[model samples]
Target: MASFAVLLRAVNIGPGLRVSSADLRGAADDAGLADARTLLNSGNLVVTPGSSGAGSAADVARLVEERLAERVGQDVSAVGLSAEQLDAIAAANPFPAAARDDPSHLQVHVPFGDLDEAGIARLDLASPGREMLATAAGVLYVHYVDGIGRSKLTPKVIDRAVGAPTTARNWNTITKLRAACAGLASR
Candidate 1:
């Protein structure tokens, strides 16, 4: 069995799409994923496909989405990454200083599709702060130099700029998810 880090998009961020961590874990378990664990209420999950026959990360994501839809009565998009992929994303931290000094200001954006360069350029043009942006391994790393709350780089701006929906996790969350993936892989 291979472990995967599954990220659910746009859940628990607003009033209409609230899903508890327990519910998320139950959904994964019902989806035939083993060792299901949730990192936060924001829908970060780590699990292994036991007898689910999910051959790839994409398949795992699909299964999770289906289960979550059934449980929550609405569609929930998920992006899955294999253990190696998660580790690679963590290792590819472009803003190491930000991650070390101000982890909350460092965000890793995981897009549903490949990031568009033109859109990223548009985003760069729209940036109002000293935010640094980089893309590696199909993920975007952003360092909010001035802090995220006051920044104008909102979710809508990012979605418009990247031409794809993305879910962001701070450096602390990313590292925790990486460690969870490592633990799941070792089991």
Candidate 2:
């Protein structure tokens, strides 16, 4: 069974749609995913396909989304990446200094669809702070030099600029999730 990281978009950000980590694990279990684990309450899940076995990361994502929708009664979009993909993302980090010195300021945005160059250009033009953007392997790496809270690079702006729905995890969280995926693979 291959390991995968399933990232749910826009969850637990408000009172409207709140999905607990336990509920996420339960959804994965119900979906026949084995060794399901969740990191933080922001919908980061690591799991392996059960005895039935799933096809690609997309297949795993669909199964999890279906089960989670059944449990939560809301459609939560998920982006799944294989263990190797997660490792590649980590390896593709362009702002290593930011990740090491100010990990919280570094964010990795995983897009659900293809990233548009025009949208990326728009994002660069819209940046009013000392934010830096880089793209590698279809993933966007952003370093909020002025910190995220004060920055104008909100989720809406990112989604609109990238022309795709995306979920972002800080550098710290990315490392943790990568470790979780590695652990699942080793077992």
- The window of 10 residues in a row where model 2 has the poorest summed lDDT is 50-59
Give lDDT: candidate 1, residue 54.
Answer: 88
Residue range 28-123, candidate 1, lDDT tens digits: 888888899999789999999987888788888999999888988998989999988888887888888998999999999888988887788778
Indicate which candidate wins on lDDT: 2
lDDT of 2 by residue, 88-161 (tens): 98888888899899999999999989988678877787777889998886788999998899888998888888
Q: lDDT, candidate 1, residue 67?
A: 89
Predicted structure 1: lDDT: 0.87
Clashing pairs in 1: none
At residue 163, give the lDDT of candidate 2. 86
Instruction: Work out the TM-score per prediction.
Output: 0.95, 0.95
Question: Candidate 2, which segments miss by more than 4 Å at Cα?
Answer: none
